[model samples]
Target: MAPPSFVSQEEFHAFHTIDRKLYTLLVINLWRDPVESMQVIALWLWLERVGFKNVVQKILSLPYILTNELADEAVTCLNVINNDQLASLTEGNDTPLMQSLIDRDLSLQFFDKHRLIATQGITRIVNEVCIRALRDIMQHAIERNAAQSLADSQKVISHSLQQPMVQPGLPQVGFGPDADVELPWTQESEVPPDDRTMFVTFSKGYPVHEWEVREFFTRAYGDGIESLHMQEVPPDEQSLFARIVFCSESAIEIILSGMSKAKFTINGKHVWARKFVPKRLKPSLPAAPPVNLPV
Candidate 1:
C-alpha cells in the first residue's frame, strides 16, 4: 500500500519496517487464514489518521496494549526478525527473496482456494483490524489522562505546602515555652458542641480508612476524639467528607491554630480539617400581653 498523504517519508519508512516484520509472521500462517492483504489495508488506513510512528511507539511502550496471547506472540516474533532482512525485502520493485517463495506457490490448486478464502474473509479482517486500532487509541488516551491527573495532584500539593500556615479566624499560637499563649476555647464545658466538632475532608483518589483518620488525630492532636463519623460516598465520588467530635474544644483550636488551613497528610493524600460552625436559629418573640379593647 502507498503511504498516506498525511504521513511523512520518515514515518512511512518506519511503518514499512513494522509492516514487513508483521507480514513475515503472517505469511507462515497464511495457509490457515489468507486475509493478510485486507488486514494490511485496514492497518494503513488506521496509520494514516493515527500516524505510523505514534502507533508503533504506543504499542511498544504500553503493556496494556498487548491484551492477548496472540498479540504477545506477534510482538515477540516482530522483535526476533532482523532489521536488515526487512530492508532487503523492500529494496526494489523486483520481487524480494521471501516474496518469491509465496509467489512460486501460486501455481498450486491450494493457492486458488486460499485466494478465494482471502476474498470471502476480507470484511472480517478489516473489522478486526479497525477494532484493534480503536482499542489502541482509547488505551493511549486513558494512560495519558492518568499521567496528567497525577501531575496536577502533585502541583496542588506543592502549592498547598507553600501557603502560610497562619489562618484567619484562628488564634496564632506558638509552640515556644514563653509565647504567652491563650486558648480560644478555655474549657470543654463552655465551648459549643459545633466548636468542638471538626469537619474533615479527604483528598480524592486516595483510600482513607476510618482507622487511618482516627490514628492521624490521635497521634497528632492527642486522644480527644469523642466520636468519628464518615459520610458514605458513592463509588464514583472523588473525595470524602467526615465529622469528628472532640471531647475537648482545645483539640479543635490546636488543629486550626497557626495554620492557614487545618490540612494534614494521611495515607499519602491531603486531608483538610476545620471547626464545624452550626447555624444559629433566630430567637422567637414572645406574644405581647393581651390588650384590653376600649374597657
Candidate 2:
C-alpha cells in the first residue's frame, strides 16, 4: 500500500476508537508487502524530529484491544522483523515485553490487568512497534504454554504461526488505491484446522454461564463445521475462572476475525496446543549483482 496521507497525532487523538477491521487490513498489507517501510520509518523520524520523545511511549501505552483479526496479525508482523530490528526497537531498562515473553504467567497477568483501548495521538510507527511487542509477547507465551506438552502442541503451534500466501485479490500495498484501504473479504485463516483452538477465558470475578458459552461457540463458528468445546478450570483455588476452547484452528481464526464483542481473558497462561518456531525466510526476489548507485 502507498502510505496513507500522513495523519497527524492530533487527528488520531480526535478519534477515540480504532476501527479494528480497517486497522487489521492495513497492518496485514503493510506486513505482507512493505513498500512503505521506509515511509513508516520516515514517520517515526518525523515524530522524533518534532521532539516527541514520548511518542513511542504513548504508542506502547495503548491497551491491548481484542477485536478483528488484529491480535493475530500483530503477531505476524513481529514474526517478519529480523533479530537486528527487534533488538534495535527494544532499547530500554524495564523491557516489560521481554520479561513478559520469558514468563507466560506474568504476561497473561499483565494483559488481564491492562487493556488496550485506542491510540490517541500516537505516531503510526510507534503504534506498530507497540503492537509488535504485544504480539511477540503473546507468541512466546503461547509457545511456553505449549512446551509443557510438546508432543501434542507442536503441530497446533506450528499451524498457528504459518505464513499466509499472497493471493491476487487481496489488497496489497503497491497494488492498492488508498494505502490504508480496508479489504472487503473476511479475514482468511493463516493456520489450517486440526492444529488450532481459541482459548477464551472468564474473568476471576465473573464466571461465564453455560448458555453464554454455548452461544459464544455457535456465533464464533458461524457457518463452519468445526466442533468447539469449553472447559472451566480455576487458575488458583481462590480464583473462579473458565476457559472457552475452540479446538479447531480454522474455528479460532473465524472467531477472532468475525467476533470481538465478548470480553474474555486473552493471553492467559494456558497450554496452547500451538507455538511459534521461526525459520529463515527466503527472499521473494532474486538478488541482483552488486551495483553501485550514484551518490
Residue-pair clash count for candidate 2: 7
Q: What C-alpha lDDT values do all the predictions have?
A: 0.46, 0.34
Model 2: residues with Cα > 4 Å off, grouped in runs: 1-194, 220-225, 232-248, 258-295
Residue pairs with colliding backbones in model 2 are 1-173, 1-174, 63-115, 63-116, 64-116, 157-274, 157-275
Kindly report which residue stretches of model 1 are placed more than 4 angstroms away from their true locations once superposed: 1-190, 234-239, 283-295
> For candidate 1, which ten residues in a row score worst on lDDT?
90-99
Clashing pairs in 1: 165-259, 165-260
Clashes of each: 2, 7
lDDT of 1 by residue, 18-65 (tens): 443333223222211224332543433343343333433333232221
> Could you tell me the lDDT of residue 26 within candidate 2?
26
Q: What C-alpha lDDT, on a 0 to 100 scale, does residue 267 get in candidate 2?
A: 33
